[model samples]
Target: MGAFSLEGYKPFMAMVTMHSILAVMNLLAKAAFQQGFSSLVFVVYRQSIATLALLPALFFLRGRSGVAGMSVSLRGFCLIFLAALFGGTGNKILHFLGLNLGNASLVSALSNLVPSTTFVMAASVGLENVQLRSLITWAKISGTLVCVGGIMILTFYKGPRILNSSNPYLNLGTALDSVHYRWVLAVGCLLVSTSCWSLLLILQVPICKYVDPLPQALWLCLLSSLQTAPIVFFLEPNLSAWKINTVTELWACLFAGIFGSAVCFYLQSWCISVRGPVYCAMFMPLYTLITVVLAAITLHEELHIGSLIGAVAIIGGLYIVLWGKAEDSKRERNHIVDASEITISIDDKEDNITGQPLLVNSTR
Candidate 1:
């Protein structure tokens, strides 16, 4: 029972680990981009590396897959293709571009929007089983609002800097001294990028049910590589950008491929499969908190008091959401129990009535 209870948290742990890998990817990509590495080329290389890394998983998945027509048919291919476009290729491109425009901290903080946006999208389509009057629904809403609130505090209000220092990634963010107007476009890009990923999260629920998560991730990586390679080659103005010049660039690409793309993709699909998309996405706000901590440690940046407050809010909000989801699940189980008891009672009553009619006829 203890092990079983612990196993229940596997999805939670996977999501947390996924966000941690993402935080590292964000840091490495920023360092490379600041050193003049091509973000477009990085996307292509990242996807290619990820595809190659996933090849060995094919051996493990043999005979274990039971995908039906919805998974094997052309429609399944289309769904995976669209997922790759929205998440693998398109999401990475926009995310890196957003990093170029804003600091990683800021970009990551703003990305707390993903959970709320995904929630809305899922609810709109009845994927989340939302009702306006439901208390459980309100809990989800309140939690999202609080999480967004925390992220907003972190973004706009930079209180006094604590543990202030300098590091390799210190200068990665764009300075607003001459580029104030770019904020709008920067935010717009991040918003759209996040929306794309959010939609992909929702899409994966059905896709994962029909297809295995590992193969789905492999297809996402492979197709994304194919889709990205040609455009990058043609559009890239610098041939020199293709080669890895520094150790930073080399490790960044490798880690982003192996851990960021491969591991994260699999974990995400698995989490959504087990927990539902909104539950899976509710962990997104933690990305901002984890990124802040990582930035402080690696970049030697100051951890402001506001950041601590924001972190608290993010954690609190996630607790609320999980509580609501748990309550909802318990209620569902109780309803099933109640329904079965009612059925048994009706069966007993019918038996009693039939037995009485036989006794009366015999006595007569």
Candidate 2:
């Protein structure tokens, strides 16, 4: 493989790891909810446990020298805190709540919308430049629309075929019945969670610019855990119950904090740095697929044709967007090369006019 191919391998591997962690986290969240934990309580436990685990690791890795030299401006600290709040506390809370109230498979399918949201937001903020004339760009937009259409079909259109299904895997009655007013509230929470997650992806670029990925992740986990402490204390102060939970529940919380929060956060940052945010975001549907499979195995959740179609649409859209992005990157590289050649040519002409050595500083 070429250098570029090897360079690409790292982020792809990181993304694979990230998706597996997220899928496992979803399974654990489902298990926690099954144990009758509230979303607020679950998130608080996740953050606090992860924070405690990460602090020791951070200290061990950096020692005093690492702690002393590291500096974050007040504004930077605030930004990181806010990102943690929205991304960690807010996102996880809603996700847990949604899973408690809805089918995990359905929720995971809907969560596949993250890449489309990110693409739209990035384009709006001028972080991603869209070329409307390009077929690749159109493919991306069309694919996104198709994905959204599939979601709408699944959500709103229950025809005779859907209503009369006898297959155990086609059961949506419970999930559909849950869509009452209270369920709307759950959906709203899930929307907020999804939005916060997308925002975290955007904010992470700038944060990584200033701080090391691991420490930044550690601090975010710490601060989010601290932020949740008061809420968990006042709202669900039943520490005794948590203390006496089954070994499985304890393991779930530990895995969420360590593998899901600390390890995944660091890996995501590393992946984004290596692959750029677009590529990282594009692979999210892989996580969704993992979530579906795990939900089916662990939760015994039924799978429907709509779910399969929705997954395909989401993945297809992601590929289209990534194709456009790759084209944009290629164009950018070509533009840079052209500009460099122009500068060199102009310098050569000036040297010829001056009748002097070119002083090109050729190291070769």
Most TM-score-accurate candidate: 2
Candidate 2: stretches off by over 4 Å: 1-8, 131-137, 157-186, 233-244, 342-364
lDDT of 1 by residue, 1-364 (tens): 9999999989989999999898889889878888899888999989999988877665555543422222456777888889888887788888877776655666676666676667678788887767779999999899888977875665445455566653323422223345544544565677788888888877776676557778788889999999988888887967897989999999999999999998888898788777766577567667877887787777665556665676567667766776776787788889989888843334667667775666456555
Instruction: List residue ranges in candidate 1 displaced over 4 A.
Output: 1-9, 60-71, 142-156, 163-176, 179-185, 302-324, 343-364
lDDT of each: 0.75, 0.72
Best by lDDT: 1
lDDT, residue 84, model 1: 88
TM-score of each: 0.80, 0.82
Cα lDDT of candidate 1 equals: 0.75
Cα RMSD to the true fold for all candidates: 4.4, 6.3
- Per-residue alpha-carbon lDDT of candidate 2 for residues 50-96, written as tens digits (9 for 90 to 100): 77777777778889755653578787787888888888877887777
Residue pair clashes in candidate 2: none
Query: Which lDDT value does model 2 have at 303?
Result: 58
